[model samples]
Target: MNAELFLAPFLTGLGLAILLPLLGCYLRLRDEWLAALAYSHVAAAGALLALVGGLPPALGGIAAAGLAGAGKRLFARRLSGGASYALLLLGGWAVAVLLAANQPMAERLGHALFDGQLYFAGDAALWQVALGVPLALLLLRAMSRHLLLAHTYPDFFRIRGLRSWPTQTGFDLLAALVLALATMSLGVMGAFALVFVPTWLAFRRAARWRAGLLGALGIGVLAYVVAFGLALWLDQPFGPVLAGLLVLVGLLVA
Candidate 1:
């Protein structure tokens, strides 16, 4: 009965769930989906680093995120956005895989990246709560309006002549960061539902961005609650349970 263990991961996932879409919303406001692109790869690198390199590695991963963000901006102006993202994704994946293979406690690192066992409700990690919660809240506050705008109305933003690309870029960075943290806390597979499920529900039901976001948020929260319960009852992995709940929600709502 490790209470801290469960509490830690739950807090981490909750914080991440709130922060990621907020970041995406902000980036969309800036018309920079590419920013999100760079963040994804960078965050992946960061997660790998955190697992293997500890503090230094984690810092390096965060730094890589910034560098990648800048690179995406520069390349977007000069090259096709998809091409640039593809190159960066490949490069990032190569580096991350190499790091995972070489890092001194590689087994621990692998578990950190892939195992959902560490993040269940009853046995949460300390760092997940101590560090992740506050960071997520701060970022959410900083990017609030931009997120709402970006996710809700890109067309109106353009009509106003506001630069949505930069906003979107910022969102991408935040999304990656949150997703990275969540992955580290919950496992990579677990992160999938957080990104896709709510959005899917929104798409299936709502016509407006507001309605959609609301739908997603509601479904997201409900899915988490149900999935957590189901996992406990079945003695199964929480991530898959949560993901399944999302699928069910989509089916019922859609």
Candidate 2:
């Protein structure tokens, strides 16, 4: 058994649970529900490079995520939010499928990239999440107010002697980086759980914008504990097990 197994899982789970919901706060308000999923698909496509070319998939994820973020900013100018996100999501999935098809390790890569190999993730992944999570939190904290104004009131923000585009772009970059790091640790599918469930739950319950943030944080932590324990007891795949827990949480919240 890997000596760091317990630490690795805990850190990845905790780091993602905290950071992603914070990003989700902005994403939901900004109406970018599909943006995270699109970037994760890009990460999935990039991770497939690990099987075919033996490349560091994280680089692929970083590149793809950056590009998707850029695409959103650029395309949002002309297209509706739903349309632009639809294009990006379709394009990203196409890339993922193409990459998966080119690889011989299709099933293995599929499982590992799409669902995750979090249980088997080692020290490098743990360190990646450890560093990236705090950096993302700090970056978002610094930019959160600016982000709110820019996305929600672009003209007002710009009129206040602020160029909102630059700030929005900065958010896209930070969000992309966070998603890339998360995809590496949790797999693309699992990222959906970490990013959306807590935010949705928080927003649904809270009266004030920030009221349920802490509650969402608590829910995130509990979700991980429950899912992790259940997976262990059931001897099941951890990623799918967590995904199921998220869906159940979503239902219970509803």
Candidate 3:
């Protein structure tokens, strides 16, 4: 395999390997990690819809997940115990399947979305990650303190007569957009794995919040690089290879 062929894809995945785990730390802190899976699924559905409508799949995905993120507050009030996320996941899955079944072109893209097309990711994906990762980091850094307070001390804002909705809502939108971009490159379950596994291991092993963030980033990057190499050498799908490596790491850590 030519190294140049995969360089762009590698860099794109690497960016998400860093960014997703960082966001995962916050999602884990808030006990809202399920949002990753929900957003990815919805993004997949949106991409399929876009394919059918002759639009850019990434734009549709980001728009759909952004909407989902913005509406999270309303969903929280109407549904409890993460029910809203579950509904989104199932609904998205159903829509994606139906769209793919009805359109031959959509079927091919849908398979790519489900299994991951990282190796096929082009200049567009590279540019997306190039711009997105830094912006996301800046935003997260600015909101880090408020996020911590919002999650760890839910009543702190209330006591101070401050509304926490803005902070929470902003984070939700950020997560959705990031996950949508990731889903376009990494596939639904692959993006979710990055968000779930690294943070989970860090949560178990790290002694401090800062340490946990570092640990998750380290774990995600290491696994992603290794999986990328192994998949390229072994002629396997990147998504499953990455997920398997993470699970193996989890078992070893356990």
Candidate 4:
């Protein structure tokens, strides 16, 4: 294993190992865990479309997911809870498949989006994670209290005659952007697994909110490091290896 070649990708995954699980804590709190998968699917469709247009796939994915997050309120008005997220996921999947079938370039990008190309992640991905993670953390910190209040006490804002749309929409956009970056780096299912499994485990075991967040972050990073090394040693795909490891961990913890 060449350290020079693997370092950037390792760091990229590590950054997501931290960021995704933290966001997952919030998603689990809100009972909107499905949003991670939905955003990743939309990002996949956007990446495929970008490939067809000869644009940067990551950029397109971020843009598309961001749009979906921005429009989440509208979707919520028509369909509440997991239904809206399901709609986005199905719509995104269909568009991605159709685009991939029509374009050879898109087909290749689609495979990368689904299966992940984490081993090939370069300086670009590292930089994206480095810059994006801190910004996301800051945004999340600013919105943390509001999010907690909104989820724990649904009518906290309404009782005060305050609108929560800004906080909700802002968090949605943040989640979309972060998930797009994760999907581009870790693949759709890989990103979703990172956001889902660790948080689920932490929520089950931790007695307090802060403990849950830290536990989720710990679980994610540990699983990612193990998966990264195992994937390399066994010459396996990183995404499946990571997802599989998380599932096994979940079972053990359960």
lDDT of 4 by residue, 2-83 (tens): 7999999999999999999999999888889999999999999998888788898889999999999988888787787588
lDDT scores of the candidates, listed in order: 0.58, 0.75, 0.92, 0.92
Candidate 2 per-residue lDDT, tens place, 1-254, comes to 44355677777777887887778777788788677887787767766655467667677677778777766777776877477666766776787787667666744666676776677677777788888888878887787788778877888987899866556777877777788777777777677787788888888879976776676677777887888778767877777888889999899776
Candidate 3 C-alpha lDDT tens digits along 13-108: 999999999999998888899999999999999999998999999998999999999887886878888888899899889999999999998999
Any idea what lDDT model 4 has? 0.92
RMSD list, candidates in order = 4.5, 2.1, 1.1, 1.1
TM-score rank, highest first?
3, 4, 2, 1
Candidate 2 Cα misplacement greater than 4 A, ranges: 1-3
lDDT of 3 at 57: 91
Q: Clashing pairs in model 3?
A: none
**Number of clashing pairs per prediction, in order:** 21, 0, 0, 0
Clashing pairs in 4: none
Q: Which ten residues in a row have the lowest lDDT in candidate 3?
A: 157-166
lDDT of 1 by residue, 1-254 (tens): 66554665566566556544444433444444444444445566665666565564445555666566545656676666466666766676666667767875654555445545435433334454457657755765666666566567868867878776656566445555555555555555555566565765565667876666666666666667667667767878776777677778777777
Candidate 1: RMSD to truth = 4.5
For each candidate in turn, the TM-score is: 0.70, 0.91, 0.97, 0.97
